[model samples]
Target: MITEPARGSTVTQTIDNDTADMSDVEAGAFADYVPSSELQKVLTEAVSLLGGSERPGQVAMAAAVEQSLRSDGKLAVQAGTGTGKSLGYLLPALLYCLHEDARVVISTATLALQNQIITKDAPLAVEAVKNVTDSELRVEVLKGWQNYVCLHKLNGGYEGSEDDLFSTMEDSLAPGAGGGGEAASGRGTKTARQMRGFAAETKKLYEWARETTTGDRDEAPRGISARAWRQVSLSSLECVGEKCPFRSECFQVSARDKAAQAQVVVTNHAMIGLEAAGKQNPLPPCEAIIVDEAHELDERVRSQASTEFSANMLATCAKAAGNLGVSGSEELSQQAIMLGVALQNLEDSRLTQMPEAVAECRTLALPPLKAALTELSAKSGSDAGSDGEKHADAAKTAVAKAALTSLLDTLETMTPESVANGETILWLSRGRDGDQEPRLYTAPLDVAGKLANRLWSEHAIIATSATLKLGGTFAPLIHKMGLQLEEPQPETLDVGSPFRHDRQGILYLARDLPAPTRGEHPEVFWDRLVELVEASGGGALGLFSSRKMAERAGEVLRERTDLSIMVQGEDSMAALVNDMREDTSACLMGTLSLWQGVDLPGNTCRLVLIDRIPFPVPSDPVIEARCAAVKRAGGSDFMEVSLTHAALLLAQGTGRLLRSAADRGVVAVLDSRLATARYGGFLRASLPPLWPTEDAQVVLDALRRLHQKVS
Candidate 1:
């Protein structure tokens, strides 16, 4: 694995060499080859059929993608919103798959984008390519095993320990005296009610499983809990492979088979992360990878690689072992109690060093846990019995083995050697309520090494996102992704947005407002915010740094203005965005999620209000450790970790203003730091090059005029 350079280090590489002036002999080589004419024709046709006109930026991106794929080099393209980025990459990918007879995997950050590509964009690209090459392309969606319903579990072939636990409780409560007694008052009544709900949900899932051919949980009835889904689905670890009687009809197996036959496979980042971690290869082999929303790849990979342990998890493992008839199960339960007690004695914070309590728990629990896992692993699926009985036994043993293996892994991660070497960072966290039990979490200090050795080294990569470049360069994100260590360093391109940013929008920095402090913003900030919203006639999207600020802004605005005000937590984000789109004069206030993927065009959104710079909390475990690492490496942690994060989010929040060529609005930043800080220029360069001004009146006048025209 390639070790990453120090954070904020300047690692530069030249752009892809222009082939226009090269001789035919030199350019004919794969490295210097230009995009084929066929690529342009297919892309043009795809755009035309999608009801869009030609975009220079999209064409440029497509050409770069084609060159990268043909030469087997890494490329990072920042195709701004409305530049038709999806089609730009999809067209080249489809063409490559058809002509080369090779496969390509397209990984996205969200399921919504996956669905959009599979249902809408992929079909259009296929049709466009078919029209040109007279050949067809096949696309498939591949997800984790847990996403599909396991016929073995749904068909009553596997009764897990959870069912046994519930049964024990019901039997224990069965001896209650006549109806309407103490049994109907408190705990008993609540248990009965919960049991009914669980049964109802499980029954519904069974019915749906019979009717739905795909067996995907995403297609199941809405409002199903994760607990209910677990009853019918199997994790990768819980699958019994060929031992299951339902293997012939398993949805997950069928999906994998389909992916093997597909020319293009669409999956999420988590699946890629799992593969990169050497956990499992859920996807088939592919020649190239296209990571859309590539900015989110690092964090998603980190989340998948991270693991947590709690008393409840230990209890679950103990129950599974007990159900599997393993020895030492009782000792495991005792160790769980001891561990819970030790956790309660410690506070919730990042552990700079290993705690004695944790070490003691590990030393005591390791033996029993290992012994149970050994016995469970020794159990065989091939026993002298009926096929039905053997199938059920195999499934139950798989679940027990998986649970014990996960518990053992968590214990191994807590070793002092792992924590002391700086390979991992450990922390303790809990639920929102104080009474909730604390859980221990351990994550890799850096995922760059893993990603370098596993992903970039193995495939030709084309990573694209609107916000990949930070502080006017792609070096920061590239270095973070470990792409800088690749043999032929990735080429970077910025196909600017199709929208005329300077003509259609204004970046309003509130220079006169007081510098924001820790707690609440000054009343003057609220006053200025109201002024901007009123100027835009209430067509405003407020992106705050925290939920408290967003909710407070919503409350104050509803009282101060006559227009409609919708808070994010008031309803579902989809419903809230739809309402904001339908009601022209309504103002929507939200944090984090609203910064990206909230697309409202034309009159529905005339202004955007940013409360302050969205910076990562310094006390966060991962952020804190990363900053210390940079500091130790003689680098500026603020620049490498904090400022870059803020810039990306600020850019995303700013981009929410313009969704189309016709969009016209003002992005109003209430914080004065953007104009006063020394790093202000760098942050400004990260954003769209809008017509900028420090005066609030200039923005107000522009908004009022735009609002008047729309009205």
Candidate 2:
């Protein structure tokens, strides 16, 4: 095979390669699905139609899900990469919703996964079910109401900053622009060229929203920023549902209505947590719940259940009340300013305890605002007018009411008793820039009890992910997730991956390098990494420990090598991934999100470089508090929390190497801790059974041979 170096990226490979072969895998002990059963036939047909091979691990996971539905059993299963886990659980979900007369809800981690299930997997699964059962299936995808475009907010129905609403996307996204982090201080902004570019881009969004079937942000065309999208989007606080003039054409309402009739509803983890935590009930009732990408469930739940109090939100509240023509708004506005001042002072001082100024603001400043909002909410749109006018007025009032209610909830979380009881943690979380006003945050330190009450009690529950077991066991995840807090605990199963990891992948630990230290210079890391990427001919996905490391590596590589190099946040994530796929020699370097969801199978990705172990920040309040609590309860804080978290992330990072059974690659861990530390054994056990090697020459030789074959 003839290979060439990338023009600037120094990547040494050509773009052409063969498509990955994904065939059916051998069945294991999980073959006990009722033969000739409606569920079985539909699943069989769906696999056949997917134009891929069946995997035993997939079948095993599906059987677990189906059985849980058949009985009332709860299940926790781990299906590794290339196991076709999505279809494994989805086919049964569809069969149950259609054949067994059950309602099923599938919640995932990211919006992309939600769409993939609803748009790609669900359609194929439905067709397969139709073929076998001769039944029409109803599947709907639902996100939070805020995820949809609010007709009122888009058309200047709100009372605040509509004239300059999107004057500068930079201002809107600036530290304090919309009143969240810092007051929109108009500090540093962009060029006239950039603003013109933004104007054209946002105009495209307006046109697309009118013509597009789904007004969801994911459906938007390329180059549209979040700041631009938020102009057309709605939050619960800003929406007046059922009162807007364009309710008939509302994307959010339509989606919810469709979900009401759907037998199967696909959503993400955050929406499910909100539905359970809040009384509003965003979704219809479901008899069965299936959570995919179950690894991130804890973090999503924490975020959904938490709320932050900031000056910007307070400013919005005051404006919403004044729009109702409230008489007391003059005093309320003054109090809102005081509240903002108190917040700024509290954050600036960096004190842990609640200050007197903040307490007074909450007591004296907040009550009048609440009263004004309530009065307006109670009599909103009462002035006699045409139906259209009244509807718009009511929508505005709804927006005010939503904000008022949310503020009260935020207040409750920050109250002394709530913070003292240990059920919730109230702390001041600073911004990326220390000078920004610190927002008061209230988050659940643990959601176990809440899940026990609202989640574990479901009729049937199935949780599956590529990396669920913390360290060779499901006990940690199950216990922490509150999956076993109720009667009839879930049955645990491990459906191993179909890929021959032992032969197809290598775990190359760079023992010659020194351990990664926070303050130490990383010249050694760059030297080893650049050499490895050159040897592999540029099919590498580099996962770094921090943004600084990623930047240094990216800069050094781009300056020294001729390979195509892409860094995170430099462009939209979608564009970077597309460029990498098109330019095979390109090396995509980033942290976090890229670890798991990225899929560049076969020759396009043959090398993965992990800068270091992904341990939680030592200063993170939440993780530190949890670890302390575990230590107090007679558990090893390092083992139960720190090591466990790092192990799961390492498994996820390493799993990126061999995405298909036919794919062969190497995962190089630049950190020497995996070889020197004692707990390394546990982490290694949690990963796939990749062949181990320490010699750089061995890996370089293997990469060359694989690169030749692909060429």
Candidate 3:
């Protein structure tokens, strides 16, 4: 174990003992080793340039990351908030790329984090590396094809189709036009106003698309909605590839080209997951992968690996086949109807085995789908010959072929034999309304095996996050990631936060409050919540487990007091957070996303109110299936699946307080479970070591004092 030194102190510990054993290996095995002094010097210069002070945890983390990259080993780091984790990993990644002349891929979970690394962190690291090594290093951002505007779609290529952006805008401008549906006979004024807004935003996007060189959606005007962007962009399956006249100047291709030429490539977790699923290798080959928000990797990979089948999906495939002049298009459409009927008859639950009716529909549909795909593939390959019509036909055929190929792959995965084999989990999910259709979904029961085979075996991995180790240890996450089975098992490190949690914050456990029931909290819970907000004079962040509870709390607080209250769905998250930051007396209430996504520093956020322990709903199909698997293996499902989920979220929620060294606050858990339940100790260990108190008045007094100080 490596112990991090005190704040502003230099780290003296070497790499872990296991790494020391491999220090004398052959030349080519670990060739890109950079001395620890060089890493520290680069980090020091980067910190100086960024106008930040030195922290021992950041120095320790940088050394650990460097050791992992140098030994070609795996590591998981838990660097708490205020540790400067981005620079900790970036400096080493940049140094490795400079020394070895090999590419390194850095993946993050969110677009905000990806943009932060590229725009803020990477450039400073590059400069630091250049200052030390006297060599320029290149870095590029690579995203999915849909993230950029499609030239073919932006032009008049799909002019007559439902995908045409200009046609959609024109329709929106028509009187009584309801966007997708036909004009309502007497549409209300509100509907008309909304359509006009959509039209205006779409027009702005169109004008911006014409002038932007990169075509990246992130660079476009801010007001555009996702629905408008879809009209101008293309999904991977919708792209015509080399058959299009705009192939050479394609933005997605250009981004990939730049990434290929760079030494460090920044991408997202979903892209890495897609490559692991054998869908497509969207990333450049790299010597190592540093997953920065590492806690979200497993769930993100499962999302990418999951497949869904719906009537609308099949109907769209049929329409694409019809566009390509495939003969069996009608048959495929009929099968889609049959599949929808079969799914309607079934309840929404995880399947122990595939139903006969569903299996029959899938089996009957495969042949015609395959035939249509074959014909489309042939047409897609035929020469366009210098004629404009022929070229358009070729491009359309290519896109249709890709769509059919994707449909075929989904159908094969849903085959009865595949479902019965115990390798996949199949379930049926319905939309929120009764009128909406139910869809069949399948995902790998476990992604550990896939990640181990496809990712860990190929590259050195450093997975770092603020919440990687739940319940006081890394074993759970390590086992979940399948790193326990690796040849050279991953090393673990916990470079503690720079903030003095005990001195800066309090963990207030409401021991007298009743254990929360399933639906609504008791009246007493609301009373206590109001009291806390009043005590703090309202710089509070309310973290709820459900939207209903969050909204109800907002209503109660808004009625009970005069402070400004903001709910999650009332406005954009960015707007809500900004409002909270600007007005120190405002309260922002939201659900799961607010737990880890927000970073509100200073006196603006002085209280974090947690409604209860955030446990996964037992009725969720994936949770049910995973719990069953764990129980069958003779393990406690509560500890493995349920408790860990709650613990991780609890840690993340607790972290919302004390964002900086000077910040002070109280993380008040309104539920008594964290103080009286059997698992309380485990959950408490996962959080920052704050001063704990059970007396409500003690916390109220502390909050009042902090409020007075800030006021």
TM-score, candidate 3, is 0.91
What root-mean-square deviation over C-alphas does model 2 reach? 5.8
Error of 1 at 274 (Å): 0.5
Better of 1 and 3 by TM-score: 3
Q: Which stretches in model 2 have alpha-carbon errors above 4 Å?
A: 1-28, 31-36, 152-197, 327-338, 347-352, 381-383
- Candidate 3 C-alpha error for residue 630, in Å: 0.6
Clashes of each: 0, 14, 0
lDDT of 2 by residue, 157-264 (tens): 664534221222233433544442333333323345677887898898888877777777777887887767766776665566556777798888889889989989
How close is every model to the real structure, measured as TM-score?
0.89, 0.89, 0.91
Q: Judged by TM-score relative to the true structure, which candidate is superior, 2 or 3?
A: 3
Give the per-residue lDDT of model 1 (tens digit) for 389-415. Answer: 788788778877777777787788678
Worst lDDT 10-window in candidate 2: 8-17
In TM-score terms, candidate 1 sits at: 0.89
Judged by whole-model lDDT over C-alpha atoms, candidate 1 comes out at 0.82
